[model samples]
Target: MNRKVTIIASNGNLFDAYKVFNIAAAAGASDDEVAIFFTFDGLNLIHKDLHQHLPVPAGKKHDLERFKKANVPSIPEMLQMIQEMNVKLIACQMSMNVMNVKKEDLVDGVDVGGAATFLDFAENADVSLTF
Candidate 1:
């Protein structure tokens, strides 16, 4: 059966971005309704420029190389894949205001909204995760 999956991403690191995308992609591929709520640092994952060059946390440089060598999809590639799968990508409006992020700075097709919006989507989620 199809399920509802909600993910909360509040981290800025590459690892967290990978985790969030991996989970969302998996759920979406399984025909789940996936929504990712990006708040705080997590918003970096959806930032058009930042997402293309997400920073690897110190000491994890080797892991990044490994992922690349293993042919792990790039952040932009994963975003495209998920978008094609129709996953919901929401950028937290409050976080944007506090962080000085503008809608134009985000990738195309992302919805800009507040907590109530995310909560409303997550309300019936069969799986909810934070990364």
Candidate 2:
């Protein structure tokens, strides 16, 4: 059987969220099944309109320019890369309701679910991480 990993993202911080996806993608590439559950402010990661807006790292000088110049992946690009690698991205339906975000507003391929749904994935995961 394949390994299973679940990542729960609750904060909206860009760096942390980026790390979660990066790790998950690496695990998936190793033949593990990875699922990322976005809740609370983390749901912003899936919002179609907001996905492309990369947050600037605080106290970092010229970091954005360096990243751009090096062709580092943007948040949206990272998300797309995860999807292309078959990593599942799930957005919390309850959070979306509270945020007044519609299904159409989420990025393509996002699976919408509630707490129980995420818990199911967690139950079967060999490794679980909460961000």
lDDT of each: 0.94, 0.83
Model 1: pairs clashing at backbone N, Cα or C within 3 Å: none
Cα distance off (Å), candidate 2, residue 32 = 0.9
Summarize candidate 1's per-residue lDDT along 52-110 as a digit string, tens digits.
Answer: 88889997788977998999999899989999999999999999999999999999999
Q: What stretches of model 1 exceed 4 Å from their correct place?
A: none
What TM-score would every model get versus the actual structure? 0.97, 0.88
In order, what is each prediction's RMSD in angstroms?
Answer: 0.8, 1.9
* TM-score between model 1 and native: 0.97
Model 2 CA deviation exceeding 4 Å by range: 69-71
